[model samples]
Target: MDFVLQIINGLHVGSIYALIALGYTMVYGIVKLINFAHGDVIMIGSYVVLLSLTELHVPFWIAIIVAVVFCALLGMLIERFAYKPLRNASRITPLITAIGVSLLLQNIAMKVFSANPKPFPNVISGEPFQFGGVQVGQVTIYTILISVVLMVLLELFVLKTKMGKAMRAVSEDAGAATLMGININTTIAITFAIGSGLAAVGGALYSTAYPIVDPYIGSMLGLKAFIAAVLGGIGKIQGAMLGAFIIGITECLTKGYVSSQLSEAVVFAILILVLLVKPAGILGQNIREKV
Candidate 1:
């Protein structure tokens, strides 16, 4: 029963990781750039919801919507101002810029919200659902359901929508896609918008689960999501989801049966193993290029 409960707890955390990983994968696929600042979007989203709910007295759902919109716009802005200008420059330039942007946002957040950790409001409150000896919290169930629905929607959007087709084209070959009359810049911006918005959703869910907001909170969460993305396959959406569950379940099981202090070490160890065995990840394919 304890083991089963741990699995459930892992699923809850995994869902949040999946949400964040989706953003990472989508942005990478379209732009081929790892947005290090992507994680901080989660922090920004949490604060938006916090301020909305606490200051404006808005409902939790409304705050989530507000945060999603705000983050989406922020994502687009970041891409336009920070990334777009360096589109043709060396990859390292954008990479450094991304790190710089991350630091800039963290400092800005620290200046505004301060460096203290704040308690996030418990949006879902109720007794745990009991099934035989196992009990599941309302928050856990809600997180799982919402994350699944969002994942399904994103999959459908990418596979069935025109913009999604353009995104795929951009991912495969940007020059060819541009010759085919696709607006490369627009497609990339939209990808960032979607990814960042998903990060907001993850942030909102994470705040409910962990119930704390700190300036540096997104740093570790972002690393976890990045690892999940790499573990499942960085460029593959399905791979991201699968990796997230594996990571979440493993971390939870470690914490339950082993030391909580060692859980993170275990997670990092798994990543190292995966990299050694499958550099392209579980679902990733390796392509050979001739110079």
Candidate 2:
């Protein structure tokens, strides 16, 4: 029963990672850029929610919506100003710029919100559900349900919608997509918007689970989610989800049974093992380049 509870806790944390990983995978799939600043966007989202709930005195759901919209616009702006100009540049150039953008966000957030950690208000209130001698927090249940629903909606959008089809086309071949009349810039902006909006949701859920918000929270969370993306095969949407669960569960179990300090080491070690054994990732397919 104790072990089962740990698994539930893992799912709670894993869902947040999956949400963030989806953004990473989607952007990488279309742009082939890591967008290291993606994590800082999560931090921005959390702050949005924080200020909205505390200062604006809005309802929890409304705060989430505002955060999502703010982050989405912020994402589009970042893509427009920071990434668009360097779209055709060497890959390393954009990579470095992404890191710079991340640092810039961190510093800006520090200046604006200060370096202190703020307690997150409880948005969801409910008693833990006990089943078969195991108790699960309402927040955990809500997180899992919300994550699953969003993923399903995303899958439907990507597979069925016209813009999604355009996105698919762009991801396959931007040149061909442009020739076919697909507005490459708009599609990319939309992608950033969706990814960043998802990051906002992720930020809200993460703060709900951890109950603390800080300027630097996104850095480590984003790194772990990136690891999850890589573990599940970057650029593969479903793969990112799968990788997040595996990572979440592994970290939880390690922390539960092994040394808490060693959990991070174990997660990284798994990444190394996966890269050595299956560089393409569990659900990733290796595409051979034609010389």
Candidate 3:
């Protein structure tokens, strides 16, 4: 029963990780650029929700929508102001710029929201439900259900919409996509928007679980989500979810059975082993270098 409980806990955490990982994977898929500022974006989302709830006295559902929309718009702004301008520059230049943006945003958030952690209102009842000898929380079920729904909607959008087709075209070959009349700039911005929106949901859900918000919170979770993305396959959406569950389960089991201090190390070691065995990752396709 304890083992089952641990697995349930892992799934709950994994669902949040997967939501954040989706953001990383989507951006990487379209642009081949890891937006380091994404972490700060999640941080911003948390603050947005907190402000909405506490300051504006908004309902939880409305606050969630507002937070996600705000993050999506912020993502669009970042792509327009920061990334788009540096498109023609060296790869390292953009990467460094991303890192700079990340630090800048975090510091700004610290100044605006303060360095201290603030508690979030309990959106979901914390009562646990028992199923097959496993105790699960309503919040956990909500997170998983929402994650699955969003993933499905994303898949449908990508596979069915004209804008999504243009995105795919640009992702496949930007130069060709531009020549074929696909709006590369628009597609890139939209990709960032979707990715950031997903990250907002993740931030909100995570805050519900921990009920605290701080500037540096995103740093650790962002790194872990990125690891999960890479572990499953950086460019694969489904792989990100799978990797998240694997990592979460491993960490939970380790902490429950082994030493808490060594849980992260053990999980990362396993990540390294998986990468060494299959560098492309479990669900990744073979990426050929451009000549």
Candidate 4:
């Protein structure tokens, strides 16, 4: 029973990682940049929600909505102001700029929001919902459900919507997309906005479940999410979530039976081995370069 519960806990954590990973993967797919600031962006999201809830005394759901929107808009602005001008610069330039932006946001947040961790108000009331012999918290169930729903919505958007089609076109070949009359800049910004919105959802759920918010919170979680993205195959939408579940469950099982300290080491070791065996990842496809 404990083992099952552990897996559920892990699944919830993995779902958040997957959500954050989507932003990393999406931005990487279109721009070929890591967007190191993404994790900090999530940090900002949580702070926004926390402020809205505490200072303004907004309801939980409304606060979340406002936070997500704010983060998405901030993402668009970041792309426009920080990245757009340097789009044509060398790859290193943008990458460094992203790292700089990450540090900048973290420091600004620290100064503005303070370095102390704030507890998020728990809006849900109840015990774990039981199924057969296993027990899971309503929070866990809600996290998983919301993650799955958001992922499905994003998948539908990417594969079916007109904007999604344009995003896909840009990912395939920006030069060709430009020649085809696609608005490359708009598509890129839209991708960032979508990715950031998902991150905000993940951020809100994370703070709600764990009930702690801090400026530096996104660092470790973001790294884990990035790992999940690589593990499942970057640039593949379904792969991100798949990787998240795998990592989440594995971490839970390890922590349950094995030493908690070594669990992260073990998980990362598996990641290295997986990459060594399959560079493209589980669901990743290789693109051949023309000679």
Q: Provide the TM-score for each candidate, comma-separated.
A: 0.98, 0.98, 0.96, 0.97
Count residue pairs with overlapping backbones in model 2.
0
Q: Please give the distance, in angstroms, between residue 56's alpha carbon in candidate 2 and its true position after superposition.
A: 1.3
Instruction: Kindly give the stretch of ten consecutive residues in candidate 4 with the minimal lDDT sum.
Output: 116-125
Q: Rate the local accuracy (lDDT) of all candidates.
A: 0.93, 0.95, 0.89, 0.89
Quality of model 4 by C-alpha lDDT: 0.89
Q: Give the alpha carbon lDDT tens digit for every residue of 1-291 in model 2.
A: 879988988888899999999999999999999999999999999999999999999998899999999999999999999999999999999999999999999999999999999999988888998887788889999999999999999999999999999999999899999999999999999999999999999999898888889899999999999999999999999999999999999999999999899999999999999988999888888898979
- Candidate 1 pairs with clashing backbones: none
- Score candidate 2 by TM-score against the native: 0.98
Off by over 4 Å in 4: none
Model 3: per-residue lDDT, tens digit, 67-174? 999999999998899888989887788789889889998999999989999998888976787787677888888888888888899888988999989988887889
lDDT of 4 at 129: 88
- Estimate candidate 3's alpha-carbon lDDT, on a 0 to 1 scale: 0.89
What does candidate 4's lDDT look like per residue over 143-253, in tens digits?
899998999999999999999999999999999999999999999999999889888888898898888898898898888898898898898888888888889888888
Report clashes for each candidate as comma-separated counts.
Answer: 0, 0, 0, 0
Candidate maximizing lDDT: 2
User: lDDT for model 2, on a 0 to 1 scale?
Assistant: 0.95
